[model samples]
Target: MARLELENLTKHYGGQATVRGVTLDIPDGEFLVLLGPSGCGKTTTLRMIAGFIEPSGGSVRLGGQDITHRPPWRRNTGMVFQSYALFPHMTVAQNVAFGLEMRKIGRAEREARALEALRMVRLDGLADRLPRQMSGGQQQRVALARALAIRPDVLLLDEPLSNLDAKLREEVRIEIRQLQQQLGLTAIMVTHDQEEALTVADRLVVMAEGEIRQIGSQQDLYERPADRFVAGFVGRSTVITGQVREPGLFESAGGLRLRCQGATAPGAASLVLRPEAIHLDPPPDEHNRLEGEVTFASYLGPVLELHLRLSAEDRITVHLPNRGGAGLIRAGDRVSIGWPQDTGIVFAGTA
Candidate 1:
């Protein structure tokens, strides 16, 4: 295991900057995830760290050693690609032994190490089977074994679970996290899946347009977002616009009134509301009160989604739990809903 460091790392293509000056210091044996949407420069940044692409500026250091210009093989980092890049002609054991063979280990020792790695991923018996004969999950295990055979200092995964089905993806991700923790490996993964990042990453870096938006644990980013972009991107948020009349008082042009529960300043305010926090058919409260007509309702398994069209040209989405028909409300029902004083946050700006 080793600590990874990136200082002012940057990359440019022609005159456009793909990755800007992003700096981060990751501790040893930590799992860091780079999460963002498509074309967010996350993959480019990972390639720069892997030494596959040279950076335009800054440095990459592993365990206090400068390896900014080192070759990919010399960097002692293992990469698990999204495609599961394995030689189809070779058996699982042979493919796993290829790394050790490149390092010039003897045949007997290389075979032993390959078997050990296969055993770690619970694929020892399938060592002789070809990738075509195995399932997608099995092929993924073979790729993992190949990456771990030479025991590289760091492990890098690039969307290693995108191809699998929903259930299998969850299972494989859990196995990967467990294996990483058991081996005490320093791992960095690049992914756009929010749930996957929240599940496996010790910490996550949310990036946008080649810049870092926020870096923290999943709870920190989900509960206390840094800005409007972070709040909307991290979770489902309903933003209502209004102007603050007093410290906690806000009024909209269509006669919608709101009183937030914090030390807020008087300005244009955005009331950010989470779906699960709002209750239905409640009396008018001092904090928040609104009446709306349900335009649509979707019956999800565990929860029911209610799409409400409120006054003031505002819309609100509510998620109600389905505990023995607790969500027995239908469309076109004019209902009054109120939330607690702390259910919504008042950002002193409109979006």
Candidate 2:
């Protein structure tokens, strides 16, 4: 395993910056995920680390050695591409051994390492099968084995599970996380899927446009988002734009008063309420209560997602557990919702 560092790493195309001054330190054996929406520089940053794209400025260090100018072949990094990038004609074992062969390892050692890597991913039995003969999940494991066969200092996964079906994606992500932890590999994955990042990463770096928004564990980001964008992106949140009227009060744009916590300096702010934090038919003594007309309801197995309109300009989403009687609330129904003051996170911004 190796510790990786990016120092003021930047990328530009035609004078337009795509990645801006991203400096991060990834400790040894840490599974760090770069998470953001499309075109947000997460993939570019991963490619830069893999030496597939030359940075416009800054440096990349691996295991305390400067490798900013090193070619991809010389960086000792293994990359699993989004497409699985397997050779159609080559058998699984051949594909996995390709990297070892490229490095001129002897034939016997390459074969041994290929089988070992395949075994690691539980695909050794199908080593002789062609890529086209296997399932998508199997092909993905072949790609993973190929990367691991190289015995790289760092493993880079670029949207590794985006091609699988929902069930397989979840299964493969669990496998990947288990393999990563078992091997203690210093891995960095670039993904737009928040759930995948939450499942696999030890720490997450949330990026936007060309810079980082926040970096934290799954619980930290979900429970205490740094801003409106993160609160909405990382999880489900009902964001209310308004101004702080006092230390414990917020007035929404629609003129609804709410009891909140976490912001003191009363300027323009946004109240971020997690959907799960709100409860239906709160008691009379509840600190924060609101009555809204249910606009829509979605039954999602264990939970019912409700969209409610508080007024012409204000709406909030609430998630109620799908316990025995949750189906009673439906569209057009007037519902009373309430949450504790501290349940709402108030950030000092409107945009």
Candidate 3:
């Protein structure tokens, strides 16, 4: 395990920029996730760390050593690619031992190490099986085993679970997380799946348009995001556009008013509302109460997600837990949705 550092990392193709002055520090043995939409340059950054893509500027450091200019094979970093990259003709054991064979280890030592790696991923029984004979999840484990077999200083995973079914993805992510923690491995995983990034990361770096938007713990990102992009990208957020009506109040253009408890910054602002914090049928005189009609409702087994329209352009989704609320609300139903004024965050600057 080793500390990973990215200092002012930037990349370019001709004159077109992809990653720009991105800097981050990952502690030893921590699982960090780079999360964003497509074209966010997360994969490009990971490749730079692995010596696949040379950075146009800045540096990559592992522990105390500079590795920005090292070639891919000499970096001693294990990478589990999106494609799995397993050999069709080789058995799982042979594939796992390939790196060792390249380093000229004895046949017996390579085979023993390969089996040990397979066992760590709980795939020892499938060591002799061909890649095509295995299930998607099994092949993924084989890829993981191959990466771990080399015992690299850091592990890089590029959307390792994207190809699996939903259930399988959940299962494999849990397994991968446990394995990483058990080995005390320093790891970086890149994914566009919000749920997966939130589930597996010790800290998340949310990126967009070639730069980092925000970086924090999962709860921090969810509860106190830095800006409009972080608030909207990390999770489902309802943004209400308004101008400061007073010290702690705001009035939308559509006439909907919100009493933001801690709002001191004036002028054009946006109020971020989280679905789970919303209250239905609260007291009429409560702070931040809005009267609206339910426009859409969907039962999601565990919660009912309802979209309420305060006006044509001012709408919000409220997630009500399935605590007997399913029968109480429906589309076209008139309801008063309210929440604690402090529950909503007032973000200055509206776009």
Q: Which candidate wins on TM-score?
A: 2
Provide the clash count, candidate 1. 0
C-alpha lDDT of candidate 3 relative to the true structure: 0.90
- The top-ranked prediction according to lDDT is 2
The reply for model 3, stretches above 4 Å from the true place, is none
Cα lDDT of model 1 by residue, 22-140, tens digit:
89899999999999997888999899989999999999998889999999988888888898988999999999999999999999999999999999999999999998999998888
Each model's lDDT comes to 0.87, 0.93, 0.90
Q: Report clashes for each candidate as comma-separated counts.
A: 0, 0, 0
Candidate 1 regions with alpha-carbon error over 4 angstroms:
252-255, 261-265, 283-286, 348-351
Over the stretch 1-351, how does candidate 3's per-residue lDDT look in tens digits?
799999999999999889999999898999999999999999999999999899999999998799999999888789998888899999999999999998899999999999999998899998889999999999999999999998878999999999999999999899989999999999999999999999999999999988999999999899988888889988887888988878888887687877776678678888888999998878867787778999999998888899999987798999888987456678999888899888887888877
lDDT of 1: 0.87
lDDT of 2 by residue, 200-242 (tens): 9999999999899999999989998877788889988888999
- TM for every model, in the order presented, reads 0.94, 0.97, 0.97
Report the Cα lDDT for residue 12, model 3: 93
The order by descending TM-score is 2, 3, 1
